[model samples]
Target: MTEILDTAVDFRATMGRLATGVSVITTRSGSTPVGMTASAVSALSLAPLQLLVCIGNHLYTRTAIAEHGRFAVNVLGEDGEALARNFAASKADKFAGVETVDDHGVPVLKDAIAAVVCDVAEALPGGDHTIFVGAVRHCTHRVDCRPLLHFAGGFGALRTPRHA
Candidate 1:
């Protein structure tokens, strides 16, 4: 077996170098809407169109998602750094001044590069985080927008590829 090291800082630093797309995960808590900025999302399967998002167990959005049974993944565009920062904060009014629309009882960002509505299929314990496997129920996307990326602890935009 490989030796284990108690180096969370090192692990985070190394993982930060792996570029990831930013997204706002949203769900409803009673009559209130809740959301948070997240990068721990992935497509789990194509046969059944499933996705997974890892959220801190203590987070309000996590609790909301568990209660609501539904959530939306708002994939941020290149210009969504501000939105990402806003949602990343621990403020109560994260949605203030932000435009949104309701879809399947969940709030969806109006200008996301893509929005995916999902029904919770499974909730698995993942250390301090809970991995929610969701089945895609609906989706919308804008092909013209570039996705916002996170790398090295900072937000960035993807460089346009050149074709010969």
Candidate 2:
């Protein structure tokens, strides 16, 4: 048991070194919007226009996503680090002052660099999280914005490669 616990700690530290784009996964619980900052989102399939997001088993947002059967991925812009931190915190209302627009019954963050509305295609049980596969239903973006990124337990803006 001690060995397993140590491995979990080491694994988390190792994964933190991998930089990822920041996003807020939003869904409606009844008429109220629920959201959480997630970096575990990824594209799963192209033919069917599907994506996947992993939500912690203990989060209320995960329950809302499972029950609602729909969600929106609000990919943060370079100016969105504060918003990401806001959603990342456990709170009763992360959207309290955040402006949003409706996208297929899901709340889309108005200032996101990009957003995608999706219908929950499949929900799979992972070790400590639920893997939600979503079939995209809508998409929108702002071309002028640069994506927010996460690395080593902190948020940052993307720096384009000089060679490119």
Candidate 3:
């Protein structure tokens, strides 16, 4: 007989093995800017130029995105690990000393490797998280930057393997 190991801890551990690019999902709540570090972001479609981000239902940023109907995905570079850790926390002021600029009415990290401003197209429930589908309105990138990555519960930079 085969045994099925299905537990929250096990699920988390299993999923943590998958490496993903790090990004900060930013939006505005009223006049205040809000953001959260998210690895659950992904490009959803090409035709409509859409992307999706899964935000926790309890996150204030999630509520902000829904209310404002806009958000920006700031793709972090290698030097953004500290910023990522800060945003991941439940800090009252994540942007205290962080430099940002307004892009499409959303707060975008100035040092981001890339930024994608989007309008909320649809929001769906995903267990305890809200899956937000964004229609990309504007996008920008810095070719010189290398992306930061998250893997096995830690942060890292992408490394190309040397050919033999």
Candidate 4:
């Protein structure tokens, strides 16, 4: 029989088969912005409008986001790979030359597929990561482009619709 640990390992390895939307989880302390490249964001609630973003609990970004309480999730479109890289680096100057603005005093990236401003409502311990439950405070969208996606540890392009 497969042990519990072995089953969990297999499940995690197979999780890559499930594609997910890519996003950058961002926060600011004064004028300085901090962020992380995350493919782990997911919507959790609709009535109160909540979202969950998984973050490695040991990273600086986790602490920063916790301290800030207010943060934004920037939905990067297919062409925004560069932005993703910039934000994912450790304590890197992610804002250098990046087109962004303080959305109602919260850091929001410009030209995102969509930007969601939220406040940290709850934090739960998820196995290797922390699941941040944030309450949506504001949102903006541009329907012209499709969202960036990730699968099997690589970037993915949007699928085209088929003709009937």
- Give one digit per residue, the lDDT tens place, for model 4 in 1-164: 45554576677767877988888888977667887789888888999999989999988788888888888999999998778877777656878887888885577888689999999999899987888999999988997688778787678778764659
Angstrom error of the Cα, residue 65, model 1: value is 0.4
Runs off by more than 4 Å, candidate 3:
1-3, 161-164
Residue 62 of model 3, lDDT score: 92
Per-residue lDDT of candidate 2, residues 41-153 (tens digit): 99998999999999999999999999999999999998999999999998888999899999899999998989999999999999999999999999888875778999989
- Candidate 1 lDDT by residue in tens digits, 1-164: 26654599878987898999999999999989899999999999998999999999999999999999999999999999999999999998898999999998899999798999999999999999999999999989998688999999999998885669
The TM-score values for the models, in the order shown, are 0.94, 0.93, 0.94, 0.87
Query: Whole-model lDDT for model 3 versus the true structure?
Result: 0.94
Report the Cα lDDT for candidate 2. Answer: 0.93
lDDT of 3 by residue, 105-145 (tens): 99999989999999999999999999999999999999867
Which is the better candidate, 2 or 4, if ranked by TM-score?
2
- Error (Å) of candidate 1 at residue 160 is 1.5
Q: What is the C-alpha RMSD of each candidate to the true structure, in Å?
A: 2.7, 3.0, 2.3, 2.9
TM-score of 1: 0.94
Clashing residue pairs in candidate 4 are none
User: Which residue pairs in candidate 2 collide?
Assistant: none
Clashes of 2: 0
